[model samples]
Target: MSTDTSARWRLRAHAALGALVAALPAWASAAPRFADYPVPAIYQGRAAQPLLADAHSRNYATRLRDAATEKPDFAGRYVLATWGCGASCTMSAAIDAKTGTVTWLPFTVCCWDADVEDHLEYKLNSRLLIVHGARNEQGGGTHYYQFNGKRFAEIRTPPRHAPHPPGDHQ
Candidate 1:
């Protein structure tokens, strides 16, 4: 009778463990492929500038690479600062080596400010895709543009936040 009870507990434990493992979110390596990029051979516009492609497409990825290059073993991490625009404004995006889809991480509130200027920094992920169009202060008007391994879409941003303190915490 005791042996039978032990066996049942063990079986239940195993099932619970399996369920927990299945519920976990996938890691960057396991992230789903967002889109299929174009071949560089058919790339249009400016010549294939490998570094530029990564730098201009994403912000965080570019910062990580620059830090890593300047100082060995630079950590690929960043903080996002979203400037508040009164309904309808453009947002810049950035990608990382492990990032599948480019996420917009605006480094600066305004696009004009060079020091805190918001420029899209690109990095080599598996493939590259660009999302253009403005996002309202609340949320609306989202668009997407695709880039091969090279070439980036030109986007203009309206004045969203002031460049005084820098952080867009308002």
Candidate 2:
């Protein structure tokens, strides 16, 4: 195609995509938020022993068990245990405080350049989790997920934050 024709075609495609995105339902396009998925209530029961049935959980049993002994730090009744696998690499699992079941985050996060103390962001009374860094060294960016008592479901349309200025890694 000629240069001018290609330019017009590209513009039309961009417009079409924008229109389609604007038509999506609020829940489909809106970012996943902690407040939106609040825990039913704060957990008051005693923390259960960490169960290590899955291969991943079994591999990290010691760490998982130790972390699970602490009070719930995620999703009201779950302890989100995180540990470093290597430099700048982190692996995480969620241990149910009410039950003893363990759930892994599917992939280890690494290859990030941020200056934060940790890459995982979560709260005790919220089901939302935000991971800062790459999942399995794929690409570096912020990722969001929501825990639904069993496993985490990643949110693909989380809001984007402006990039830090050059030379400022904080």
Q: Residue-wise lDDT of candidate 2 within 58-107, one digit each (tens)?
A: 77889998998899988888988888999878888899988988988989
Q: Candidate 2: deviation at residue 50, Å?
A: 0.9
RMSD of each: 14.2, 8.6
Q: Model 1 segments beyond 4 Å from truth? A: 1-15, 18-121, 128-134, 140-170
Clash list (residue pairs), candidate 2 = none
Native-structure RMSD, model 2? 8.6
Candidate 1, residues 77-151, lDDT tens digits: the string is: 211122334332444433223222344543222223335333222223223322223333332222223343223
